[model samples]
Target: MKRRPRRSVPALLSALVLLAACVLVAVSAIQRILGERAWIDYDTVAATLHNLHWTDLATAVAGSLLALAGVVLLLAAIVPGTATVLPLAGRFDSGVARGGYRTALRTAAAGVDGVSTARVRLGRRRIKVRIDTTRTRPDGLAETVRTAVADRLDRIGPATSPAVKVRVRAPRRTT
Candidate 1:
């Protein structure tokens, strides 16, 4: 089974805060049970609770907010993180890091003659290559770039081969 990615920074920080709160509560409970000086004052807490009106709108709003926070934290922990790497075809588990595939595609496109520059974007189901060429006839340039990018992707043998879409643009003339 593939391991889930790490949680986001905010999720991790929230978890840490929750852990610390639990530890503090546990320590306080132990101290109170052992007749030692507890960090929290039980008398004050009881008095505050008795004074609060449970039916008040503020109490209801506070309770709702607390419930919503718990739900958000639970969702963060249960949901799988976003995928940042594309899986490669191989006997063992292998993946190409983000931007690696783009770089490879760009290099392959740039290797073609007359190509001044190449920009590539790799998506889940499509690969878009934008090429700036100095060649007069750009009619056939798109197909050529597409073929080159397709061949490069085939060589890499990723789990899913994205369809290649090539766009040829004329190079800007400099005075």
Candidate 2:
């Protein structure tokens, strides 16, 4: 089973805030029940709520913001980010980093004649490569890049070979 990435910052902040609130409420309740001096004054809280009439707009905005935050947190916990590692086809459980695959593909594609630079984007089901070349006639450039990238992918022995798409573009001339 794939594990979800933890949103540590938001989760930690929310936990700390909830813990602090719970502690404060528990402490005040215990003190009040034991006939000791309570930290929170119920009369003052009641009066403040009773007299709070003009601040409804502010309260509504705050409530909406809180609801939006809750929705974001929920989505973050439920949604998983793109897989960073691709599983290899072998007896032993092993994988390659997506960055490593992309760098290798870029180097392989750039090695083609007339190709100045290469940018590769590797996805779960496809590999997109954009090649820039100074040559006016980039004939068969896409085919060359496609074959080279496909061969490299084959040698990597990933569980599934992603489809390769190559786009060749002329390098922009500088003044």
Candidate 3:
């Protein structure tokens, strides 16, 4: 299936700012070495661009390329597998969907007898279900909850089995 890219405006802006800053810093250092006559300053260079006194244009071009490279690297580091900035429509709802699935599993597990509490976690690759039973002899409690979870999820999709885990703690003793 073709999945769309997820876009983040703030992240893109931050990358652009970082790129500009890097380019400015590189240009300044190069100018300082080449003396004040160098047209590295943004305003001076823009007004007297026709001067072309030295090969500073080459330095500027190199700096711009370096800045572009930095932006590409930043995007790659932040966006996982994507090397370039990909435009996306809106944020993804995977978190919400996973939460809903987890909630369903918890509710179903809690419905079982002697189930004290159920903590369900659905991960990107798998689903983990933890159930604390009220009795020492949990017996078929784990199997029951596992079956319940599988059945509930069957309507939507199939899950990797043995993923549902039920932990039975010792029964609480009366004071």
Name the top lDDT candidate. 2
How well does model 3 score by local distance difference test? Answer: 0.64
Residue 175, candidate 1: alpha-carbon lDDT: 40
Residue-by-residue lDDT tens digits, candidate 1, 129-157: 99998866666888888888889989999
Q: What is the C-alpha lDDT profile of model 3 across 64-164, one tens digit per residue?
A: 89799778767755764321222222344222244455677788888888788888876544567788876857778888887887777664453233255
lDDT values, one for every candidate: 0.83, 0.84, 0.64
Give the better candidate number (1 or 3) by TM-score. Answer: 1
TM-score pick, better of 2 and 3: 2
State which candidate, 1 or 3, has the greater lDDT.
Answer: 1
**Residue 28 in model 3: lDDT:** 84
Residue ranges of candidate 3 with Cα displaced over 4 Å: 1-96, 158-163, 170-175
Candidate 1 accuracy as TM-score: 0.59
TM-score of every candidate relative to the true structure: 0.59, 0.71, 0.46
Worst 10 residues of 2 by lDDT: 1-10
**Number of the top candidate by TM-score?**
2
- Candidate 1 vs candidate 2: the TM-score winner is 2
Error of 1 at 137 (Å): 7.7
